[model samples]
Target: MVRKHERLATAWAAGVAGVVFALLMAAVIVLVRVALPGGADGGDVTTDSGQRSAVRTALALLPFAGIAFLWFMGALREQAGEGEDRFVSTVFLGSGLIFVATLFAAAAAAGSVLGESPQSSDFGRRLTYTLLTTYAMRMAAVFIITTSTIGRRLGVLPRPLVVLGYLSGLALLVMGANVPWSELIFPVWALVLSLNILWGRRPASARPAAPA
Candidate 1:
């Protein structure tokens, strides 16, 4: 019963993290599109007002990610105690830690840029944007791959969902390779995984256990 509740809690955390991630992505996309093109005339673009707003919005979602990470770790610990191998769990934990660390680095970068004057050169602006996008995409790739591996080992997520997770991981890899369309894949994959978390379930208990 406690194990069941733990699974439920992990699923709930993942779902909530998905929602937060979606909102953060929306805000980021809006900020990027609106603030990137005009160079220095991009009022407050490189300053504390606009940059800080975007950074704060993104950072606000990090706690949800952290929650999901903790729940995942708990699940891993439980599985290890239940005699499952530790290799995949270790990978998941390591990759998740790396992903979270990147988020912190990205947040710091945004803060630094925002705290600066708005007179950055166009080349510098583009470089910064590209760096941010690349780092974010890499982090997403690591997270998807690790989570999908965990789902496969745990036997909790459905087969189709696991497949989609792999596909999403591949898409992130392709995006990291600089393909233009890979950007669309991450959010779609996130939405799919989130929905799975929201709706997936384990069998309910009844009167008695079946004979072995």
Candidate 2:
């Protein structure tokens, strides 16, 4: 009974954390893109008050998004329990940690513009975009792929979801650097997966009793 309760609690935690992370990440990406209409490859931006404010808001929310992502990752790993394959689990853990670190690094790069010279701002913007689109998203792709693989093996995720995860991962991996706003796919995927977990979770009473 206690184990069942713990599993249920973990599932709820994963769902909530994933949703929070997804929404916050999507909001941050949108705010940043809206503020920098020229995209990452564009020239240095004039420090318009509105754009600065948007960037600031995105930066402010970044840490919370990171925190929620960490919680979500941890909860999902907990769900895997002892049945998880060591190799895939290691890749999953590594990719997620790297993605978070790169994400923070990108955020720090973006934050530099809030108090720096125009030249510094330009450099920061470029660096932020590169880190986010190139490195972070690739890591995210790996994380997604590994997660999908794990889910498939564990039978936790449905076949369609597993396929969607693979497609999302592939898009992030192949087109994230070249295609604008491709990073949004990650949050969307996360949101869908989280919703599935939440909706599919069965009540303790619904489980068949263990052998006496």
Q: Please list the C-alpha lDDT of all candidates, in the order they appear.
A: 0.57, 0.91
**TM-score for each model:** 0.66, 0.93
lDDT of 2 by residue, 1-212 (tens): 99988999999999999999999999999988888767766655555888899989999999999999999999999999999999999999999999999999999999876765888888888888889899999999999999999999999999999999999999998997688889999999999999988876866577677899
Worst 10 residues of 1 by lDDT: 33-42
Those runs of model 2 whose alpha carbons end farther than 4 Å from true positions after fitting are 202-212
Model 2 weakest lDDT span, ten residues long: 38-47
How many pairs in model 2 have backbone atoms within 3 A of each other, for residues 3 or more apart or on separate chains, i.e. clashes?
A: 0
The model with the greatest lDDT is 2
Residue runs of model 1 more than 4 Å from their true location after superposition: 37-44, 47-84, 116-131, 177-184, 202-212
Give Cα distance to truth, residue 10, candidate 1, Å. 3.5
